[model samples]
Target: MRPYNFSAGPAVLPESVLRTAQQDMLDYNGTGFSVMEMSHRSDMFHSILYHAEQDLRQLLAIPSNYKVLFLQGGASAHFTQIALNFANGFKRIDSVVTGNWSGIAHSQMGKLSDVKVHLAAHGGDLYHYNDLPPASQWDISPDSAFVHYVINETVHGLQYRDIPQLGKDAPPVICDMSSEILSRRINVADFGVIYAGAQKNVGPSGATIVIIREDLLGRCSERVPNVWNYQKHIEKDGMYNTPATYPIYMAGLVFRWLQTQGGVAQMEKINTLKAQTLYDAIDGSGGFYRNPIQPQARSYMNVIFTTGDKTLDERFIEQAAVRGLMFLRGYPVLGGMRASIYNAMPLAGVEALVAFMAGFQRRYG
Candidate 1:
């Protein structure tokens, strides 16, 4: 039996996608070879990548003007790539610091150029996430590379419900939608660049998916290495270096599975229902438990809440783990429990988690 996996990521994949891959593992489409053993340049592999990119573009409704490249860097590598592409002629960037990941992004860019790490509105816990910096306070530059924000901060269980419209005063908007990409519907046209590491929401960890506006790629600073540059990957059709063939293949399968599930819009509806079930349980669990973000900014992907008593929280996780609820613990940077309900987590999975939480709360409330 599969346990309800709430791992932040490298998390859960749809069983159907996995099953299909398993079926095709040994003999891919009667080609007499495993997909794993196929050459990346083979016609079969080309078809896989071609369809994967097609599915992704359809899922996100990405425009033809944007280039979608499946690169090798994790989001961490993107920390430098973003700065590399934009900071060549530009000197500064505007970023919002919500949690550790964004904080690291802010700091990493600091090494390359003058990154103006704008202070954001952060409340103490999950209940206070909506406190955002006023639009008026956003330091904007007409020529600044881009403004970065995580639509969903996986660690803090914080989400920006609406993209902050900085009017025409700010630089182009760039987003890291790693943990929540396909879980909900996003206006792809709203962003200048959108990137995600495939592990969490896509399929596996090693591959990073970058969607960039075509015109922005060639402007990188001369100091930027060719391999790390977005234009290089774009020009090479993301095969510049040896790609993660297996993960990319799995991602393609998963993308096809997503198409069967009615794409991102349909998935968004199911996700909303799943998140609400879990959040409602936490909210109604009484003063015994507390969430850290404000109501409006609560993340549908990662639900972070704390049991007032640390010892009891530990016990709750321990008991839940034995019951087959796994990876419900918080990140080391944040000392609390987090339930990451990504796209793969079905409505039943969230329901199971809520049932477990209620039973746990009843015993220890």
Candidate 2:
């Protein structure tokens, strides 16, 4: 049996998706060409892209006003591209720093000479990001271009349970949902732009999915390159340049798998059960295992916990790997444990991890 993977990104994929990819590796749809070798402009690849978008739309119930673009450069590249695209005329962009990714995005936006990066809200101190500041406390600038926030902070294991209700007059909300996009249901119209790297929940590392309102398409800065511009991508149907064909195709398969499993609503139910099971293990460990994030903001995707001893933590990771529960180590910046239970992670995988955690705690507690 394959080991359960809990790595953050380039992470676990559904086993069925893997099997399908394996079967089609050398000859996709009897074309005698691997998807990796197929031309992005080919009719076969176009069908792959078309079905991927349509299935995703159907799964999310995405509004007609939104344009879904499959682009490359990962979510990091879009950090700069987002500023260039939407922050063109405005002098300031509001960013809420809840974890490492958002902090990086805020810093990247600050590198731009024209716009100011406003600190809208933060989880906690620089060293410990254990709690989310309520949206009511966010000091949003009224004249800012848009409000950018991460729906789920992968490293810190913090999540916003509900969408932030910024008043009607507030600027558009742009979100980076790299870790938890399709795992839950979100209204597409709630935000001006929603972008996620495909690695975590979608499929693989190369493709980045951007769902943007049609009106926001016209805001791309003239200085931005055609490849990085959203409007240019939308014009070509997300093919302004050669796209990440293999990853997109893989993502297409995952989308179909989601539909067969009864779609995002069903996935959310399973994901909730998995998260609650793991969190229950940690919380019920009698202080042997501890997760510092507040209960309300704890993530349903990434669950972070530590045994409070570095030696014990290392030993736990080592033994978990030996037992076929892999990648239980936390992010380097925050040293402990993080089990990223993305959509592809089955409940059985989570239950195995929980069993391992209980065994480790009993041995060392």
The top-ranked prediction according to lDDT is 2
For residue 355, model 1's alpha carbon misses the true position, in angstroms, by: 1.0
Worst 10 residues of 1 by lDDT: 119-128
Question: Model 2, 1-365: lDDT tens per residue?
Answer: 99999999899999999999999999999999799999989999999999999999999999999999989989998888899899888899999998888989998975754899999887666326877877798889779999999989998899998878888988999999889999999888889999999999999899999999988878887788887789988889888899999999999999999999989999999999999999999999999999998898899999999999999999999999999999989989889999999999999999999998888888998
What is the lDDT, from 0 to 100, of the residue 143 in candidate 2? 91
Q: In candidate 1, what are the lDDT values of residues 40-124, reduced to their tens digit?
A: 8888888888888999999988999999988887988888788878666676677776776777787787575555544343333
- State residue 321's C-alpha deviation in candidate 1, in Å: 1.2
Please list the residue runs of candidate 2 whose C-alpha ends up more than 4 Å from where it truly belongs after superposition: 126-128
Off by over 4 Å in 1: 113-130, 134-136
What is each predicted model's overall lDDT from 0 to 1? 0.81, 0.91
Whole-structure CA lDDT of model 2: 0.91
TM values, all candidates: 0.94, 0.98
